[model samples]
Target chain A: MNSAISVRHLTKDFRIGIRGLKLRAVDDLSLEIPRGQVYGLLGPNGCGKSTTLKVVLGLVSATAGEISILGEPSATSAARRRTGFLPEAPYFHKFLTGRELVRYCAQLSGVAASDLDAAVEDALGLAAMKEAAGRPIGTYSKGMLQRIGFAQAVVHDPELIILDEPTAGVDPVGSASIGRMIHAMRDKGKTVVLCSHLLGQVEQVCDRVAIMDRGKLVLEGAVEDVLSRRDRHVMTIEAMTPAARTAAEAALEAHGAKITSVTHPRRSLEDLFRELVTGSRDA
Target chain B: MKDSLRRTLWISRVTFLEAVRQRFFAFLLVLSAAMVLSSVSLRVFDFGHGELKFIADFGFGGMFFFGSVLAVVMTAQLFFSEIDNKTALTLLAKPLSRPEFLLGKFFGAWAVLGVFVLVLASLQGVVLWAREQELIAAAEQAGRIPTTFSIVGLCQLVLLQWLRLGVVIAIVLAISSLARTFLFTVVVGSLAVVAGQLQWIAQDAFLRPTDSPAYAAFLWISTRLIPNLQQFNLADALVLGSSAVEEGALIAVCLSGLAYLVAYLTLGSLIFRQREI
Candidate 1:
């Protein structure tokens, strides 16, 4: 099967102001996003990650090159029908209950009428928003908003899902919940393209990652391939007294090797926060 | 075709729900109802016209003025709010076409206007009927003829006003598609309404044998592009049976309004398709 998404030499130039000055947002960017894995598109603010996603999803027209989603030409209704998108900082009508909004999106996405109830309930459950589905969106907190947005995106059971800044402004507990939802999607054989600045979460959940800077692709590789340092080695030994440490250093010296700095492996603050504040509610 | 219509209806359904919940809609409904009810108390000042005619005219004037404001400002606000808030980014990213989105907005706004017009017209009708009954009793007792109104004519006028506002909403949507600010679309849309009200002048000039071809061509285009909003302003003649309206004339006016509505909506959709989210 082909990759979930494919972009070749894609470029985007936006005309700004009354004079129509060209502003290059994405420049000659190419990437092949594989299927059924959690992939992260990461960059600093205004680095064109969102722009690239928009172009792939057909929200913004590309200035040059070609792109496709699920082996079909991008921007066609067929392609979009199999794809789902949740934009950054999603805003829905305040008058609608959470279930109503998700049901509305499901109908727009062409979900079958007979299966709509099951689809909506399943999606809400996945996002852990089932308990609050009947409340009007105006009363939702930031975490609840993101959860509802997730439910809406997945309600139609699309093959591929693109989430931009899903964890923005969300607390650690909320962010962890989202990470779990992404994992659930991946386990279900659905391709998930995540765009976020939360590097720790990205490192933990993403199987492959692409980093962009200044409208250009700076790095793309499997997480293990890119993160592993082959030139260095580490050895952790328990009950090593001073004499044993000296012997280890002496053996390395005899073999023309040197002992560098030693440090213990430590978990990240995010992991620690998730551990300590595991039961905290967004309310 | 079925899918497209379904999508448009979904958009319209949501848009209608959003619009009806606005404080602005409620505020205007109340204000217009007040105008209709107060017309009964102010019937003595009749301006030499019959009491029922004066009351109907006052109510129709309120509906026209407030309805225009709602059509121009509220429609622009609704369209731009999606863009400004980035909700369009989510909806348009779906399989929904730009035209579907535009048409949805049109129907939604039109539906709201339909409600507005129906409520005020019904209230005005009741007020007129009550006053007509009293006047008929007085006239019968004094051996004079009683003034009356036509319910069918009032319904026809309501349909015409709704179509007129639909045209206005379409024009404003086209402007909103191209405009960068909500205020700009409202200003230009209001100006367009004013120009459309005066479009009959251009139509008259075009009919005359002018020496300047360029001026004639300009007036010709203006007359065709700007709908003659005055044609829909037959409230007194239609509602009070003051004058006879030709069958073909009513159909022609309706067809013209529909043409303008479709043309502007197409133009707006084309422009919106190229816009970057």
Candidate 2:
């Protein structure tokens, strides 16, 4: 019933060189990701998104503040057991097949022997990696690697999954696939925290977004709440003659409202691309 | 406790698999095997020393050198590969503790070195046995007593060598936990091995009287800090029975090796827990 993750007043500083100069990586960061929603953490490189995730996962020690995962202390094994993480540019052992890698992670995540097979299979299927699961990881393309990474992270069925740069270096088709996977996670009542620099993809897949810059949160809101223009309005008309258009403009003018420039509704280029090239997977 | 151990074992299993697949392990195994096998033909040039002593020295030297190299270089490589390749990022994010990860790496590398020493020791044993039979026949023909070797002593030596190398692996793991690069770990680890091999000199100086208390204290700390790797070089006494080595002394050496091994691994786990993966 608690928030999926609760972070407050968090700060992280990294020491540099022999002189021990302190570099602040995450500054007064606070986030409250709701349960069972797809939340996007958007930031440029070196903007502290990855560092915050690492601190949340207990991979790095924080310099100050507090964080919790699923109502438990962030760094505890119990917290980690309920959370899953897929790192940026995920690199697995080249020698292991995709299936082997997922199974290995499942065991490490404490998946029971009785449920291990079904868990692995279900995860692989969700990531669309089941067909390529038998191949060595070294032979995988970049998209397949990310897909396999997804499978491994979700194999244990953790309540919360943190993904850093999950769609980096992936083609748009593959990126869309990951977007759908994120949607699927949300549909399953799993809290999904995603960090990516792709704004268009974030706009499509994320329910809420927080943008970061220079170790600081620049903005946070629901996608529609943040993007919608309340002051402007548009109405699409069809089969209107010049007389009808003039009459409509006069009616608006009589009400002390001016008619702005209007254009035909157009689909986004991404939509066009997806429509034309429907089944071309970046496998 | 059982679950924790199982997690540690799982990590160790993967570590061992990764280590064995490396070309460096295969290369060293072949090179060490060749040295053991070549000890026979090279025995002709023993320079008036007893044949078995020369063979034992050659084979033991190969084990010592290559085993140390494997421990220092291979352990450091295994640790750094995980860190540099970002595989540690994926792994440490799991429910596994940092100590479990470090111990898993130690055991895995130690297991690889175990196989390396076992192979070289068995080959050396075969070479020693075949030469001993030939010498027995020749001595029977000439009515001259032949110098005999002990297989039991050889087995004991193998165990000692494995313990020594395990200590070396632990030292390298401790260094790797703090090091930022593979080269740094290897250079420092190799230097540590060399210093350990010469640690006996500091122990000797500590025993003698010194005018400066400061110097004496330095020697005392130095003697205790670095392990006396030279203490385990009992090839002559163990294999050829050139001198007596008491069972108590052997047990003492094993215990000393174990103490250092545990100390270094514990220290490594502590340092690794603070490391940002």
Candidate 3:
């Protein structure tokens, strides 16, 4: 199958002020995001990662180069019909209930009338927003807002989903819920592109990642390939006495190997928090 | 086509809901309604005009002034709110086209104006009818013909005013598409409304023979570009039967309103298509 998204030599320059000075937002960036995997696009603020996504999704026009989604021109409605997007810090009509907003979006996304009910319910179920779907969005907490935004994006059952800062300003528990939703999208064979600053969550969930800096791609590879150090190794030895440790090191030295350092394995703070607050939910 | 229409309607539905819920709409509606209701008490200063005509003038003035304000300010507010709040980001990312979004907003704001016209016209009609009955009784007792107003004419006026507001909304949308801020759109849109109201000056100058080709060319462009809003302000003639307006003329005005409405909306959408969301 074709890549879920193909961006070739995409550059974007925004004109600033009446003098028309050009400010380059993204410069000659190319990417091929594959299908059926969770991919993370990571960068600090103003690094053009968001601009690149916006260009791919056709929200902003590219200054030069080409882009396609599933073999179709990225800006065409046909391409957009098969894709979904949740913008960063999403804001919705405050008067609409969560269900109403989702249904409205589903219709706009071209969901067939016969399947709309099932599609809406399935989306709400996936986002864990079913209980609060009937309440007005003004009453929702930050987590509930993000979850409902996720539900709306997925309501039409698009093949590819792009979420920009889906967990920004959300607490850890809420962030974990979003992580689960991303996993669920991947499980259903949907391509997921996540843009976020939370590196720990990106490392945990992304199958592949591409890091951008100064409007250029600095690194792109499989998560394991990029994160693992090949020249160095660590082995965990449990319940070894001091004499045994000394014998093991001497034996390794004879084989031209040496133990560099020894320390107890530690769990990450996120893992510890999740473990201690097992039942806490943002809802 | 049907699917696109449905999508536009869905957008308009939500926009209408959002706009109607605003305290701004209610506040203006109440203020306009008060003006229309208070016209009955102000009939003493008729200035030599008929009593019903005086009342009708007061009521129409209220509708016109308040309706224009609503059209200019409210439409810009609605469009910019979506952009500033990033709600347009979500909606525009869908399969919905830029033209569809603009049309949806047009219809939504137009619908709110429809309600505004209806409520105020109904109140004005009631006040006129009540005063007419009293006048008719006294005139019959004095053996003179009682001056009256036409219900059908009032209805036509309502439709015309609604169309005028629709034109204003479309104009504002076009401005908002190119504008960077709400204040800019409103300022330019209000100026456009004023220009449209005075567009007949160019039309008159164009009618007179002129040797200056540059002046004629400027007038030609002005006449063609700025819609003549004065054509729709026949409330006194239409409502009070002060003069006879030909059917062909009314049709021409309606057609002109629709042409400008479609033209401005299309221009707005084209500009908006290039906007970086």
- Model 1 residue B12 lDDT? 95
lDDT (Cα, tens digit) per residue for candidate 2, span A106-221:
99899998999999999999999999999999999999999999999999999999999999999878888999999999899999999999899899988899999999999999
Considering every candidate listed, which one attains the maximal DockQ?
A: 3
lDDT of 2: 0.93
Considering the two chains of model 1, state its CAPRI-style docking category. Answer: high
lDDT of each: 0.92, 0.93, 0.93
Tens digits of per-residue lDDT, candidate 1, B61-174, equal 999989999999889989988998888888887889888998999899999999999999999999999999999999999999999999999999999999999999999999
- For candidate 1, what is the interface RMSD? 0.8
Report iRMS values in order.
0.8, 0.7, 0.6
Runs of candidate 3 with Cα error greater than 4 angstroms are none
Worst 10 residues of 3 chain A by lDDT: A274-283
lDDT of 3 by residue, A57-128 (tens): 889999999999988999999999989899999999999999999999999999999999999999999999
* TM, every model: 0.98, 0.97, 0.98
Least lDDT summed over 10 consecutive residues: which range in candidate 1 chain B?
B86-95
lDDT value, residue B100 of candidate 1: 94
Q: Can you write out model 3's per-residue Cα lDDT over B1-277, one digit (the tens) per residue?
A: 9999999999899889988998888999999999888888888899999999999999999999899999999999999999999999999889999999999999999999999999999999999999999999999999999999999889999999999999999999999999999999999999999999999999999999999999999999999999999899998878889999898988899999999999999999999999998
